[model samples]
Target: MDDTGLISRLGDVVGEANVLVAADAVAGYLVDWRGRYRGTALCVVRPATAAAVSAVVRLCAQAGVAMVPQGGNTSLCGAATPAAEGRSVVISLARLNRVRAIDAANNTITVEAGCLLQRVQEAAAAAGRLFPLSLAAEGSCQIGGNLSTNAGGVQVLRYGTARELTLGLEVVMPDGELWDGLRALRKDNTGYDLKQLFIGAEGTLGIITAAVLRLFPWPRAKATAWLAIAAPETALRALIALQDRFGPALTACELVSGVALGLVRKHIPGPHPTLVDSPWHLLVELSAGGDEASLREELASFLASMIDDRRVADAVLAQSGEQARRLWTLRESIGEAQRIEGPSIKHDVSLPISRLPEFIERADRALVEAFPGIRMVTFGHIGDGNLHYNQSRPTAGDQTLFLAAQPQVNRVVHDLVDELGGSISAEHGIGQLKRAELLRYRTPLEIGMMRAVKEALDPRGLMNPGKVL
Candidate 1:
């Protein structure tokens, strides 16, 4: 149970070189991606295989030491960071990076949890397939964390969230037992889908070692456009029309506020005059198994009709692939721009598509009334009803003062989210940042059932404590 013995046992399971005991080496594991949370860990452990991870977990469980499973440490909600108690070990799965198999015939990619999402996408592309789970952090975030958080990105409008993309999972349970459920089958209705339990559990019930993910045919032809809409209501109507015209070809339909675009233009360097000034913008993309020329023509015709009908004010279609990438870069840079600007209160919530307009209107009004002259930077996967609704300090105000109002700001935003039957934590998991909020929003019975399940799986609570339930 002593620290020395614990480190030695962990070293024996993995290797001495993989066990980071010094403070300087473990510093990165302590802090989160957003620099919002910093926690202490007894040590950082690198396990390169499922067997090694299982051994590490068994040792930690037997010693009554908690284990925080981490991958890339790219969590938005501090889900992968350790607590400040300095009693837990941070198990980094980055060493387990590997593509176990790529079955183009079965349309699945079996990969270790440590594989970066972009790498997986690349691997799929090399094999003439598409892995659609993508976000701004795709370059660094790993598949394990993506599944743990059930991440939703712009593509969720077509491909669904991480949970939907997952076909099977290989997990190391809390007690250090390996549950090799990595079956790539599409249908096996034997009983309860146990993998679902750990998908969005935030590593509390177990650690995901690998996964079998679904893949789609590579998009043959694509079209991207930026539409200047009147408001969120207009964006919704545009989405319906686009879907009706293109059906599943409509791959992504994102809503970006003018303020969000302004931040990108101000903070990030890029070409100017590419898009017309507008109150709200919708970045829409269509992917189809047809000729590129035909797809572009169809999208152009659709835009022209929308403009004539007054559904869209003005629109510009990407003339080339590079132009499309530039348009996407604008949508993806909002988060980084916000960070560069200053400290802000960020909320990742989802509402029914029908209620999104009302939710935005009410939340905006209430926030401005509560904190006069507050700036709202709202944008996200509108087609999927998930919004990254964030607030920044007024131009003349201090960030310290604005940050101090986070708790109050959260109440105003979350209360309205509840009334609208939306989730407080949509794509983001209930990590340390939202643990209390989860308790407040979830019903007593719901919380009790979650606790019961947690107790049944991790009775000692040695798994990632202080997260989720």
Candidate 2:
């Protein structure tokens, strides 16, 4: 279809007021949040309802124009960004923000695609439940994007990833047919779980309209502690011991590297007074239904035993809830600190919990040996074996030269991740950034199967083309 004709059709679907055509107005939606990729779109369309989204998708599909689905545009990868070639229209789901229902009895809350992550959290909290998907970008990220990426956060040790937290989804297929499979059933083994297809598709297969998310009972008591352990291995041991002692009460077990902490101190401003300098620090939290004193006592006893056994060198328990939030603030600040330091090669890979120690040791040694004077900032949910293994620019070198080595660095890191029966892309889905790497790492059969599914669903390849498979 001609450019003029295409714009006219899209305007009809979402109205002219909601269609953005000015270059300056569409600039922010063109590039990704991390500036890793920059793309072009003919226009940006904001549809407030699923019906409008379907109409927009159908119009674009008929015009042979690709459609890029965007939520909060908080992707670390370029998943939400459109292609550089101006043959697509970015369908921003920001206008579909609404809380449809909250069923406390079923422990579920249904929300539209545009609802902010923090907003959903607040809504759940107000309803006396916890959303449990906490992340650094919670304040800005959208629930649809979170589900699309299947985001894993600090609480994944207990609550699981966004995929697991989601019970059902309402998506518009590539052809613009609305699939209303939003039933909050705990057991449905009737056929293939269709919702799983779009959950982590990164908007390639379809646009997610809304989701039925699982909720948990709000914790009456909470406890947090910072432990200085000998190594990641010790942190792992302590993690198991805490689980054995507290069971489901253990909410979060985050591993922090001394290098990661130092980055925060050097790059980020202000005093991180609650932070304890150690080779490795573990931020542990317990969400319980009993008294706070009992929760603290349980965690303190576990840490005391670890300290006596030499697994921990030092430890500090949060005296109050405010102190606990302070401890968490430091962990959340690591990403921002690194961002301020400047751009670096970031990898969100995951390995088996048992093999995490070896993966870290080998990957660290390999990267350092291959590239001298490289800085390794490692920290993540060690309990779930997902590490945000990132490499900082050399202190004394050309920044572009170091950044240019991304391919080699990814080869080294991703090869090891594949060798250890681990995933090259963990919480962060394979958007455009890792699309080529995904083809190389994933087997041809697997790739063919993914392609088949994509072809079957998006026959014309109009839904987020140039993305995952």
Candidate 3:
């Protein structure tokens, strides 16, 4: 049980090269992606297989030491980082990266937890399929972390979140037992959906080692367009109109604020005059199985109708694939632009589609009233009601002073989300950053149920302690 014996046993399980103890070596695992949290660990363990992960977990459990499961270290809310006590061993899944199988016939792909999301997408594409769960961090974030957080991305409107895309899971329980429920069946109406429990648990009960994800037929034809809308309400109405006309053909509908677009234009260099000056914009796209020319014509017809009806003020349709990518570049560059500006309070919340405009109106008014000159850079998957509502300090204000008002700003925004029957933590799981907020918003009975589940699965709380429940 001593530190020396523990390190030796871990080294024996996974070679000494895989067991990292030097401060300089494991320093990256200490802090989170946003640098908002920094925590020390006893050591870092790299396990390349599910069996090895189980062995390491068993050793840690016997020694009464906790294990923090980490992948890619891309968590925006400090879910994968360790604690300051340095009592736990961080298990890095990076070495486990592998594509187990690609079942094109069944429209599924089985992959290891360490496989990068972008890699999975490429594998699916190679098989003539589409793995639609995508985010800005797709290049670096692993599938294990994505499933653990139940990530929602731009394509959730057409496909779904990580939870819905997952068909099966292979998990290492808290007691170091491997549960291989990696079945790729579509209809299994047997017992409880056990895999669902770990999908959004944030590694509180168990560590995910592999997963089977659903795939869709690759779209042969596509159309991308940018519409200048008057406001959020107008954008919502336009979305409704498009859905009524195109239905499932409409793949993505993203809402971006003028302020957010301006940030991208200022910080990142790219195409100029992406859109005419407008208070709000919608980056709309459609995918179809028909001819490419027909798809473009349909989208053009729809946009023409929208403009005639005044639902859209102005618009620009991409004439080629390169132009489409350029338009997407504008939408995706907002996050990096905000980061380049400075630190700001970020809120990932969701609301009823009908209530999104109201939530924005009320929250924006309240924030500006409370802290005058505050810059609200708002944009997200409007098709799904999830908004990345963030705030930046005034140009003349002090950064530290602005950050000190986070709690107050959160209250103003979250209160409105609650009043509108919305989720304070929409796509992002309740990592250490939002633990207190989770307790505040969730009812006592709900919290009690979650606690009971956690206690049942991880009695000793040796799996990712101080996270989630």
- Tens-place lDDT per residue, model 1, 1-469, is 8878999999999989999989889999999988998998888999999999999999998888999999989888889988877589999999889999999999999999999999999999999999999899899999999999998888998999999999899999998999999999999899999999999998999999999999999999999999999899999999999999999999999999999999999999978447888989999999988899899999999999999999999998998999899999999999999999987889999999999999999999998998998999999999999999999999999889999999999999999999999999989888999989999999999999999999999999989999997
Span of ten consecutive residues with least summed lDDT in model 2: 268-277
Listing every candidate in turn, what is its Cα RMSD in Å to the true structure after a full C-alpha superposition? 1.0, 1.2, 1.0
Candidate 3 local lDDT, 1-469, one digit each (tens)? 8988999999999999999999999999999978889998889999999999999999999999999999989887889998888589999999989999999999999999999999999999999999999888889999999999999999889898999999999999999999999999889989999999999899999999999999999999999999999999999999999999999888999999999999999999875555799999999999988899889988999899889999899999999999998888888888889989998899999999999999999999999999999999999999999999999999899999999999999999988899999999878888898999999999999999999999999999999999987
Q: For candidate 2, lDDT tens digit of each residue in 1-469?
A: 7878989888887899989999889999998878889999899999999999999888888888999999889898899998887699999999999999999989999999999999999999999999999999999899999999999998998999998999899999988899998989889998999999988899999999999999999999999999888788888888888889889888899999998989888877666655556889899899988899987987888789888888889889998988887788889989888888888899999999888889888998999999999998899998788999999988886789999999999999999999999998889899998999999988999999999999999888899998887
Clashes per model (N, Cα, C within 3 A)? 0, 0, 0
Once fitted onto the true fold, the runs of candidate 3 whose alpha carbons sit more than 4 angstroms away are none
CA lDDT of each candidate? 0.93, 0.90, 0.93
C-alpha TM-scores of all predictions: 0.98, 0.98, 0.98
Measured with C-alpha atoms, the lDDT of residue 59 in candidate 3 is: 96
Number of backbone clashes in candidate 2: 0
Runs with alpha carbons beyond 4 Å of true place in candidate 2: none
What lDDT does candidate 1 reach at residue 389?
A: 96
Residue pairs with clashing backbones, model 3: none
Q: Which ten residues in a row have the lowest lDDT in candidate 1?
A: 270-279
